[model samples]
Target: MKRIVFSAMAACMIVSACATAQDGTGLSKKEKKAGWKQLFDGKTLTGWHQFHAKPGSTPAWKAVDGTLFLDTDAKASGASGGDLVTNEDYENFEFEYEWKISPNGNSGVMFGVNEDKKYGATYSTGPEMQVIDDAGHPDGKNKKHNSGELYDMIAAPKFYAKPVGEWNKAKIIKKDGKITLFLNGEKTAETTMGTPEWQELLNNSKFKTWKGFGEYPKGKIALQDHGDKVWYRNLKIRQL
Candidate 1:
């Protein structure tokens, strides 16, 4: 009987391990083998901070229920809710995250963001992967500004974002000057940086006059506050 009980306990342990491996906030065995690292840790804001915040300022973003979410109420109450940026800069990497936006909300995930006092906003230096409620937000009417597009540079061929309140999977991969964006398992946009074509697109976009927009080869990743409610989870990255 003792032997049988020991075997059952071991089985339970195995099941628990498997369940943990499949947790949304954790890396799977395969993901670990492939060198994926969890960025958010599903608990605390350990490796992130507000963009251009003074030293020791508390971030207005919250981590609860395995989500990193912007506290819009705090912003509405006049709290300093700036864009959140990764503590570490990444170059030539793949980043994936899940996001859920409120009705008529707006937000974005930006890469190559230069955190400098000279640049007043995160979008000033980094290009954005647009995030919004496609069915509710005014920006949704412009395909270039819809969720998953490369901000105003390239438009998604078709709407690929889920409705408001539903989580959508988003991925950005940048390698060797080429970047690709994916939303809900569909490729939304792709562009090669530093090319004449890229320069032409930039010249035609709103960022044309912005001195350093989309010019960084290595910079921090940012999550825009946009004065809107948004939640993000499962943020992971793999360096290329």
Candidate 2:
């Protein structure tokens, strides 16, 4: 059934050369006016690819029911795959997505990633807007590692995460060297990168030893594959 659906979609793409916003996966008129772009087109991994996986490797990621999700079954069966990333890079932009995690699941959204030999994972060079099952996950015991926290460097003032299996809205805005994080309509974390204060925060954190960490001014956006089931949708990005 998945193949049939995708085959029809493939034919449509061949005819139209690309899917349109009418599918609810492409940029809407208003979003297009705002210079926003669609990162995932819901039906296919058009602008995305598996990270660190060798050529012809089966991707652990899957598009299902208009949601892109990490297929834990594939990983459990040892169908190896890594993080997922956008083909194009962005420097400063506003990215928004809706996500839902399985019980005790762990995942993250990373930006400013310099995907090179120097970095093994996106988190090695990019800052992650932490995503996880805030209530059921072991990491939830610490506010610093809970959902909406800036991974480790910064803890959100309040936990606004919904329960696992429920959709949550998140936004990460980076502009002019300043970054801000929003969860469920509330501002959670904000900081200026490359400043003495930012450097101090980095020095105090676990990433301090990685020489290339957070040094790049621009790079790609990525979704971490922590060997857990997590679904993402409505992925849209606009340059700031």
Candidate 3:
């Protein structure tokens, strides 16, 4: 009788906990139980660093009001900070984050980014999930360059994107060489890497000129600084 009562009480507590998860904050208990780790603590850039900022200089990125933002106007002064990258490398994983771009802003979230002196830019290596103002940015003119698309490689099927300054959720799932992209609760793109289909896409795109662009089976994730103001938060990753 005591064991039955204890079990009932635990179930009730679990239900209550799931109802109160605060979005854009730290990971929930359920997420932690499922092996999810917080990439952004909502206050600092602890696990990330400037991708190519000059030695011993601070990146032109800021964390404010629980959001990480890049100042595009400041970056235009030639004090460029480049992109931001995770300190750890991941091979197959699920990554989710929320972002909002200013009017006419342009940015991207990249994975499979390799850090080598030979690579002049992060997009040269990693595949980018383009982030831009769907209606305001010039890239928005092209379906393939809009938010949640695979940046000139694959167009996101569902073109549902919120307006500027409104937060939008995006997800990237890569496991066993199959990659999937999600934007605002909709599946945007899906593809498999290293296959002939992928090869053809690579051949058609400009990335073919760059060696080993998306061939890496493992690499760091990156947030782009495309000389545009952008805000990001609620970064969470779970290894699959």
Among these predicted structures, which one has the highest lDDT? 1
Candidate 3 C-alpha error for residue 221, in Å: 0.5
Query: Model 3 over residues 1-240: C-alpha lDDT tens digits?
Result: 999999999999988878657555576766887889989887888999888656777677878898888976665575557899999999899999999998999999999988887888888889999899988888799858989988888987668689888999999999987889999998888889989988887887878888969978899999998888899998999999
Give the lDDT of residue 60 in candidate 2: 79
TM-score of 3: 0.89
* lDDT-better candidate, 1 vs 2: 1
Q: Considering lDDT, which of the candidate structures 1 and 3 is the better prediction for this target?
A: 1
TM-score per prediction, in order, is: 0.89, 0.88, 0.89
Q: Single out the weakest 10-residue window by summed lDDT for candidate 1.
A: 16-25
TM-score (C-alpha, index-matched) for candidate 1:
0.89
- Whole-model alpha-carbon lDDT for candidate 1: 0.91
- Candidates 2 and 3 compared: the better one by TM-score is 3
Off by over 4 Å in 1: 1-20, 23-25, 76-78
The sequence of per-residue lDDT tens digits that candidate 2 reaches over residues 136-230 is 77887875788887888899888889988999999999987799999999888889999998998898888989887788878889999987899
